[model samples]
Each structure stands twice: as C-alpha cells, then as structure tokens.
Target: MLDLFGDEDTLALAESHRTLPGRFGAGTRDRAGVLSALSALSQQAGGAEFGIVLGSGFEGAPDLIAEIGARHRLLGAAPETVAALNDPFRLAALCARLAIPHPAITAGPVADRDAWLVKRIGGCGGSHIRASATGSTPPGHYLQARMPGRAFALNFLSDGRRIEPLALTEQWQAPSPLRPFRYAGALARGRDEAEPIPPAIEARIAEAALRLARETGLTGLASADCLVEGERWWLLEINPRPGATLDVLDRRPTPLLLQHIEASLGRMPAIEASPTDATGAEICYAARTCPAMPPLDWPDHVHDRPRVGSPVARDAPLCTVTASGPEAVTVKEELRSRTAQVRTLLEETENSHEFQHERPEPQRPGGTAGREPRR
Candidate 1:
C-alpha cells in the first residue's frame, strides 16, 4: 500500500505515503521530482515487494512507468504499451486496421483550424485539448478533426489475451475560458440513464475495446473514451489505466483493485452486471482564491479534503462531490445541489472572523486535495 503524494493529504486511504518535491501538473517540471520521490519511496519499502497500477496522471508519462517498473513489479500495462496507446497517430492507425471509426488526425496544418482540436500526444484529462484556432500546435501535439456525438467511456479489465467489460459511463465537460474541453465528471450508465445506450451499440464498443486491448497486449484495468451519435460511433482514445469513473463504478462486492491485480497476472475475473443505482461524481472547483482553508466537518459525500491553512487557488479542484439515486437525472441534480452547498460552505468559512482566529495550525504540506490517492 505504499504510494506517493504531492501536497495532498498523506492520511489518504493509502497505508503508507511518500512526498514528491513539486506540485502536480503536466510535463518535465515534475519528472525529475517524481523520479526522486520514487527513489525515496522505494528505499522506504526496504525488501518489501509491490506492484504498480497506474491512474490518470501517469497515462502520458511512460518513462516514469518504466522507471518504476525497473525497481518494482508492474501490475498494469507495460511502458511500451502505454507509449503506443498514448500516441494519437498510433491509435488512429490501429483503429483503421481494426475497422473502428476514428476521427482523422494529423500533425500537419489544417485548412480550418477551428474545425479541429489540438491535443497533446499523451495528455490525460481534457485540459490539453483546445481548438486549433486558439494557437499553433505545440511540440508533442497533433490535430484531430472535431466529431459529433456525446462523450462516453467504456471501462474494462484485460489479461493481455482477453477483456471483460466492466461498466460504461456518460461524461460531460466543465469548460473554462482557456480549457474548453476540461473534464468535469462522469455518471455510470444504469437502468435510469437518460436515453440509455442500446445493447447493440454497447456490444460494438465493447468488442472494439477488446480488439484494441488484444492487439496492444493491454493488461489490467483500462478505459476507452469514445463519441456516439445515434448508432454511429468513433473511438477517441484509450486511457491505458484506471480512470475517474472508479468513484462511481467501484462498488461491487469484489474490489476492482483485486481484479486488476489478478488480470495483470493473466487471470481475468468474471465481472457481474454493473450496479443499477445511478451514481455520479463531479469536481467542485474553487471560484476564488482562499488564502487559507478553514477546518470544517467534511460530509461523507465530500472527499479529497485539504488540510487547514492550505491555499486554494481559483479554478483549482476544491474537492469531489458524489451522489447516487435510483435515476440518473435525479442523481445528477443532487450532485449539482451538493456542489453548490460545498461552495457556499467554503464562502462561509472564508468570511468567518471568529473561525479565522480559531483556525487550526497547518499540518505538513502534503494532503490529498486534487490528485488521486496513490496505491
């Protein structure tokens, strides 16, 4: 249960934790810091053995994966698999070979930049996706033509030989002035999901994912992002690791983590039908900067709590709000309401002069705020 942390709650679910030198973000700024952190964490492990199961943050950083794998066993996809899956050109070629519909992608200039999106080669989350018209494509980025359809993700477990579909989630974006395609949250498809995906369509998406996994030797928990309009669909990308929907889809009697471990060992677990309760999870971003976070009673539904006196930057994730109900619409509505309530709580905390005076001393810099608790 040894894991890494960066200004996030070290007291998070993991039994043991180590700290990274810098804050969390994309690119080279954090690379040396992560390797240094892993070095320290590995020594702390002593002679103990463990395996790595990656999450969203490491999708684009295969070098880090290889570095970690060199020291410890890997419980997920290999670094080469991750590198290939994260390449847009490689993905498009695979889709073409498999006859899966994929939007046209190119590194060269496009006639109508507005009609295309510039995406980083290994970007995770949607923050790296922007309209081509916004600016010239940066190094390590490519352009993909915009396609019509709603966003959906298919979650599955693979054993390098076969795959077992886990769950499908409908996704939405929380666009900001600069990040037009920022990922907001996801809602698991259930009996009450609005205009539920047809069985045939689900099967088609599942088959495509299976084919992609088999071809790439993908192992462990992974998710496939796609777009669907009516029966027509397009495979967007494969996040070769466990993704955000885990909050909504990980309630089965058998923990998906164990299943991931087993699958990585070439033993695929038999997955039962997904829970029928429509569960949703959304991020509550801070609207304004808070010089210091006030200690308050965080409701059970509100998770990823920051430490007292921690600085909360505007537009940074404050916490995650989750809700579940018999119907998807009502569950989503509840999520919105809860998100508002959490924001109001933060406002009230900021304005409380008495509480301000009584605010507890800040603890260590690391506390789980925006990043996932490493495992």
Candidate 2:
C-alpha cells in the first residue's frame, strides 16, 4: 500500500514514501511503478500478509488492485465491489436499493452548474472534483447536485454484517488557485463509546453503514462520507479501507492496523470513547512556490515531516498540525492557529534564503506509506 505508514512486522511492507525522503503520491498514475517495486520488495521482505490499497487513485482503477491481489493477499473489499462503488451512478443506485439517503446524482451535467459538482469516479480527497460549468460529459465522471449542509464523515469498523461505529468526524477542504478543493483534514467530534453522539444523526448514519456493509461485504476499517442538513443525513461515499483521520479520531492504544485486521477476521474488539476532549488534525499548505522544505522544530503535535530540501509547490500541503482539548471549539481554534504558524514559518524561511534553486519535482513516486493529509 502506498501511504504514510509502513506495514507492521507481522506483514511485509511495500508502500510509497518508503523512507523520510519520499514524496507525495500523484494518484493512480503511480500504480504501475508501485506494482513493480512492490513485486521485488515483497519477495525480499518475506511475502506480504495482505495488501491494503490506499487513495482515490487506487480506487479509480480497481482492475489493477485485482491483479495485485492475485499476487498478494488483500484485506479490503473485492475489486468488483470497488468498481460498483467507484461509479457514482451505480453508488446512487445502490443507495436506492438499500434505502439510504443520498443527493440527486446525474450521469450528465445538471441545468444549474452552480448547484452541481463534476466529480471523477473513485477520486479521493476531493482533488479530482470541480464545480460544474460546461455541459460536457467527461468520461468516468458524473455530476452530483450540491446539498445544503456541512460535511461529516463516519469512521467505523465492519465485520461485513454488522458495523461498530468508531468516530464521527467533520471534514475540511483547503481551496487554492492551484489546487481547488484540496482536502485539509478532519476533527473527531464524536466517538461511539465515549464521546457524545449527536441525537438522531448517529443512529441514522450507523444504520446506513450497517446495511451497506452487509450488502457489500465491506470489512475492516472503512469510512462513510456524509452530509448532514437539519435533521436529515445523506451519505456521499464509502471508502472500504483504513482511511485518513484514523489518527485524529482514534487516539487509543489500539493501533489502526490491529483494528483493521481484527475486523477483517470478523472480530469486534471492545472500543471505548475518547477519554479526552475533541481532537483534530489539519494540514498547512504551501501558498506559493518554495525553495526548500523549512526547518520545522516539530513538537509532538506536528506530523508528516517533509524531507529536507524537498521543494513544495503552490497549494501542496507542507505538514499536518494536531491539537487536542476538552472542547471542540478550542481544538478547532488551536488547529487553525497551528496551521497559520507553520505557513508563516515556511514563508519566512523561503524569503530569508539566498535561494536554494529548487522547484517542485514532477516525477512523484508510487510506493507511498503515509496517511493522506485529507479531510
């Protein structure tokens, strides 16, 4: 899996960002390379226990995953199921079949582009999504009618028949001229065991997730992207794997891979609510082209340290800042403040440099091992 973290000792590791010097992923474009690299690496590191694919790029191309699965055991959804969910029209159809609330989805552009968004199939982190304008129907894309409300994500553990809700998180996107709709991060507002569950919304979301999981055979750590407006809840998509915000929502001693493996094996480990207050993670992006990665005196709160001298492009995320507190509002404010501080530090470092003569590299590696700094 190409992500932020490497595989545990129990499993052979083959992921992007193999070391601290790795760059971020460029979606499915890196699959071929990751596939080749993992092939040799998997052989060397004592055959993999199972493959866990990551990101929207992986979601976009299910066939590639299927092929990889042939060589390595994969612990997530079947390729066919991924294909069904990857298609927006099919996902909406499934929602209707399962009686789940969903926004009106169109196979083509809607009349009012302002109220619609053109989204690519299987795109993650809202990167391949854009406001609909032209009536043109791009291949592998669909128009989703915008709904009124703030976005919320439900991170849950599923045994393919029953769902154990983990945490309910709020989604944020940091938009820029270069990278509009880039995923910012998430805040864990509610947990199933400890944190307070919002009145009716929690039950509705859990019911939807349970039904979908049973129907699709989704297991392990997966997330449901949803929108809540008034007393109603609408599910946007279901990512059938351990996703971003796994850290923010779950600060418990149990590691994420353990939870995922247990659920995949049909085990429901006892989960307790967060004992602390609301906690969140936010990514600070590069507002302008920078010469080199700044020297950040990272406290325990900061994560995903950039490789020294790695050039960051305009709108690309620099690093993630984290904060936890008793109140939700306080945590949110702290994350915002930290984000600004990091951005300021990067700017100051760039301006003071005699100029390192660095530019953002175009060739991004495919073998990633870190969680995306995504909402």
Candidate 3:
C-alpha cells in the first residue's frame, strides 16, 4: 500500500496507510499514480510490506519494495537498500567521514566572496535554501560553509544498534546568517527540560549519529541538526526522514507513528525515555493570511487543542500549539496563553476575510506587536 507521505488526515489518525514513493515526490506522472495507488492498496492489505524514503521527498519514484533509511539511502549502506540518498552532499560526507564536528564545509560549487551556504544537495522541509555571500553564486548550487551557532534539532530513532533520543527542539526560522533550513517554530522540551545538552555536546551528537548510522546502514527514522557553540555541537545535517517533529512523536508513550510501524515490522519496540524531568512545549506561528478555510472559532483558553482545518501556506505549516505543564514556567505559560488565542483567531479571521472580499486592510507587518517573549 504505497503511501508516499500519506495524508488522508494522517491516514485517519494512523491506521496504516503504507507506501513509499521514495517518500513523497509524487512526480513522473505521479509514478503511475503511485503504482496504481499501490495496486489498489495492495488488494486491500494482504501483500506489500516495507518501504520508507524521505529526502527531497521521493524525486523520481519507483524502487522500494523494502528500503528505509533516507537522505537518499544514506549513500547505500544496505539493509535491503532501495536507492536515492540524493543530497546534502551525503550528509556532509557522512560528517567528514565520522570525524563528526561538522560545519566548516566546502563541498562543490561556490566561488568565495565572504559568506556561503547555497544548500540543496537534496534539501528538506526548509526547501531549496539559500544564504550566499562568499562570491555569491545562487544559480542551482551547493556551497556550504556558514555555520556559527544557535540552531538545534535532534530527533532520533535508530535500531541499527540502539539510539532513541527524541525531542530537543529550537529550529525557529532558518536562513538568516545560516540557520540553514527549517523556518517555523518547534520548541518540544525535555532534554532535562532543555537548555543543557552538553554531555560533551551530547556525546558529540551521539557520536556523530552513531557514526552516520554505522556508515549508512541506517535503520528507521532519523534527524539531526546542530551548531550550539559554547559546549560545542556542530554537525549540521543528517535526516533520514520522519521529522518535522513527526507530530512530536505523536505525543510519545510509544507512537512515533506507531514506532515507524513497529520499526517497519522487525519490531525492536520499547522507547519511552524522554523525561529526565518532564516538561513540554511546541510553538509554531506564522501569518501572512491564507490559513485555509475552516469551521473556525476556537478560544476556550487554548490548551492542547488545535487542528482546525490545517493546511496553511506561505512556506507550509501555520498552526501547532502544544503545551504541557509541571514547570518550565508552567509549560511556557501554557504555550504563551494559547499562542495568544491562536493569534487572535488568525487576526480576526484575516480581518473578516478581507472585509467580505472588498479587500484592503493589509498593513500589519511591523514587528508583530508584543508577547513573543517565552523563548
């Protein structure tokens, strides 16, 4: 049952809509319409089993009867390897061949002027990124070497030799002096209630992500992005798909999408540990209007309640409000007073749908008023 980024409301809240058209790049004539919709959902679920690809979301498609370790197949580390570890320059050459402490790269393409970061050696979420300067090239490229600090993301889940550290956020708006990519909020929490990942920089980013998943033998879900500095972290890329907080591991307690379908059937299950102290938060706010129609109207002192019509654009994602308490300023003041009541009901329903279509009320882009101070 091919489900390349399946989205029938996340397979009706996760039932099992499996598919892996390289992970979501339904092009090339939608790859025979996703192999005829995975041969009619595999005769209503009887055959067809393993497959998981994510990196440039399945560019060409076809080639996945069983292959799951993305970043385009982690440069073929084989474990039933499918194909397509496409870009990010092989995750910065597997973190400099596992010396891990990345960020100081040069790969291919870039002429040098002063500041560099072209990105798209097969990008993700923060799509087609750019941040040039060092001899600015900007014309279909790949010139990284712009890593300074303050940008954190580490969502993990591996089985090729134990590795499950999930939740450690702060990937707010990338592409500014090199946040590289990821341009929306994600505050997740609990890493000792966060702000303290320095056990030798989290054991050098978990030993360079288990040495790039034991030299690319990558197993289920993976994510990494670091740059810390001052207790040092560095290593910037490596995302074998299933992250954008993968629904914050679906409020964990064992539900990382059903542990990526029970680790794609091999079943290594058992992953709870994410509360050395327990505290949670997730904030994603963006506006420029166009928040997809809805049966709107929500404001009951917002708390753990948001999923009204979803589908917002202007670079994807526009509403995520999570909040958990027990401390950490009571879950950041209940996710800052319920994301300010969902930003005043998305600015009064986009100013009453631009005054009933007569249009002309847009003029509010000056430093987003107040109340964004819960860092």
The candidate scoring highest on TM-score is 1
> The CA-based lDDT of model 1 is what?
0.77
Write one digit per residue (lDDT tens) for candidate 1, span 197-305: 6778888999999998989999999888999998888999998877778788787889989998999889998887668788999988788776677876778888767
lDDT of each: 0.77, 0.69, 0.51
What's model 2's lDDT at 173?
83
| For model 1, the run of ten residues with the poorest summed lDDT | 366-375
What is candidate 3's local distance difference test score? 0.51
Show pairs that collide, candidate 1. 7-367, 8-366, 8-367, 8-368, 9-367, 9-368
Instruction: Give candidate 2's whole-model lDDT.
Output: 0.69
Model 1 lDDT, residue 45, Cα = 70
Residue 296: error of model 3 in Å? 7.1
Model 2: per-residue lDDT, tens digit, 80-169?
A: 767776678878989999889998888774667788888877778776678887854588778888887777888898888888887788
Candidate 2: residue 64 Cα off by (Å) = 1.0
